[model samples]
Target: MEGKPEDDGGDLTRRGFLGGTGAALVVAGVPTLGGVGVEEEGVSTQLLEAVPQTAIRVTVNGTEHRVEVEDRWTLNEFLRDHIGLTGSKIGCNRGECGACTVLLDGEPVYSCSTLAVWADGREIVTVEGLERGGDVSPLQQAFMDHNAAQCGFCTPGQLMTATALLDRIPQPTTGEVREAMVGNLCRCSNYNAIVEAVLAAAATSGSGGAQ
Candidate 1:
């Protein structure tokens, strides 16, 4: 009979879920090859390879942050992992999909392609920054009212791009709206709702929309 595969004794065991301590042990880090294995001393060895870090000062959501970020880390990683801003989703990672979009200096850009180090001394804004106090911005409310966010993966990108457009042209025609949001792709195929939401937010710009 073939022997069952041995448990490598990884950090997360089945019982960890019940106690809740197992999940805490799974720290985010660079995992080395064969890092988890029983050593000669009968101890499981797991090590994280530390990477070079760079000091950067960035203004995110109107708040300034000075942090040491890994040189190899992308803007998306810095925002989601370091700053605890998980609103930017990592999709297509190559800039083809704009799910990882964020505003850099008031312009929409794919955070996945932008390096964290490159954001030094620059202003950045993610979807989480859309709310003022406890209320969502009118642009965000418009998206909800029009049912623009189907799966919501591409909503943030669409919102940022549309926001930039509105800032330039307070009132945009449907064609202009279409052109401005061309880069943001909605996998849910809800383009019409997204366009309508932008238009609605534009119409209500004086109310409480993103200003």
Candidate 2:
């Protein structure tokens, strides 16, 4: 050696020291934290990057949509947040309250209990879709006429359930209406009028605005 390398601090040069540490970190699969290039505890960068998203093509309110949505997103989240259909209310969020009800292929389902990916290639009918040409559908009119909506929180679910019932049975008896709408709970205790409204709508419209 001519004179040997000058020691900046010790036998380990700063550049060589830092380079070796960085290589060690890379081999250990350590992820960067902040600007210091240090790994954070309990934070797995690989898991963060692996969150899943899926592409879905669904027909909502008679319109078809092709969109990408997170896999964890619920149907209620997708409808209210992504598509802006706020009529479906999230009350219990555990399938207890039918407030988040919507028609899935002519059947009533709780949007909160349903998944967005499950609705792919399916048809959805929300309360907003009950209107035609700026006028509320006959079933909606019947609800107003019968004073079925007290707080109006459970009306959407009630409407959707009634719509499905009418789709199958154009004329359902009072017992049948009650049995069909049993899943939808109304906290306002307006059961009498709600049943009446469904029967009235069925009497007037053959299909209860299902068409």
Strongest candidate by lDDT: 2
Q: Give the TM-score of candidate 2.
A: 0.78
Model 2 Cα lDDT, one tens digit per residue, 42-83: 865342243467999999999999998778889998998677
Residue 165 displacement in candidate 2 (angstroms)? 0.7
Clashes of 1: 0
Where is model 2 more than 4 Å wrong at Cα? 1-47
- For candidate 1, the 10 contiguous residues with the lowest summed lDDT are 14-23
Residue 33 in model 1: shift from native, Å?
15
Which whole-number lDDT from 0 to 100 does residue 120 have in model 1?
98
Most TM-score-accurate candidate: 2
lDDT of each: 0.81, 0.86
For model 1, name the residue pairs that clash: none
